[model samples]
Target: MILPFFVYGTLRPGERNHDLFLRGRTLGEEPGRLRGVTLYEGPGYPYAVEEPDGAVSGELVTALPEAYPGLLTALDRLEEYVPGDPRNLYERVVKEVVRDADRAVVRAWVYVAAPAVAARLRARGTPVGGGEWRERR
Candidate 1:
């Protein structure tokens, strides 16, 4: 399914990967929130791990129609996601995110921590408070 992407880490605007990957490819970027996910700090980025009672702040990014294919491939690579790969650090999943503007819930692609990673994080990972990567101390 073709849907907007919910980004919470380096891919968000003003972050390191934004200019390199999404600068000219997105049609729109707006504040959004993904429920039932906890944000955790990675080495230099962040990870969203599924949780029963949590919410993550991010941006819902809509790619330009012509850039969809390439953008999707690039994002997967950036997130180190490989379908069914046990070694993958992240997995691309479809989730509902609420737009900050109008509180409209929309389906979007979300790169979340892979099973093993999520398990590890759940055991000992440091979560970003308030579920906001950018504001993490």
Candidate 2:
């Protein structure tokens, strides 16, 4: 079955990792956003953390049924997420994404940093006020 995913950083279209991980594997893509989160720039990519009223802009993509299995594996590796791992680089979670085109909301999987990691990134990494990785890059 097809699976929906919310990608905010390198996994987004045109980013370095997109072709390697998503490209032909996706059935559809739409501009989307997640509220209550702030985006911060890392060395060559960006990551998001929850915030009081912050909003992060990203893309909502549907994985093709045929590619779903491999896609999920690759994405989990890319995000450095191991099931039940407390020290994961990012936690994969289901969240509501607001489509930018019509303000429609859809449930999708998103990777979010832990609060401590967020705090560290906020203090050390550059804050992307617009909450968009593509725009900042």
Best by lDDT: 1
lDDT tens digits by residue: candidate 1, 5-77? 9999999888999999999899999999999999999999999999989899999999999999999999999
Tell me model 1's lDDT, rounded to 2 decimals. 0.95
| Residue 122 miss distance in model 1 (angstroms) | 0.5
Task: Give TM-scores for every candidate, taking all chains together and pairing residue i with residue i.
Answer: 0.98, 0.91
lDDT, candidate 2, equals 0.85
lDDT of 2 by residue, 20-121 (tens): 998899888899999878898877877888776888988998988888989999999988889888788688888888999999888888899865678788
Q: Whole-model Cα lDDT per candidate? A: 0.95, 0.85
Per TM-score, the best of the predicted structures is 1
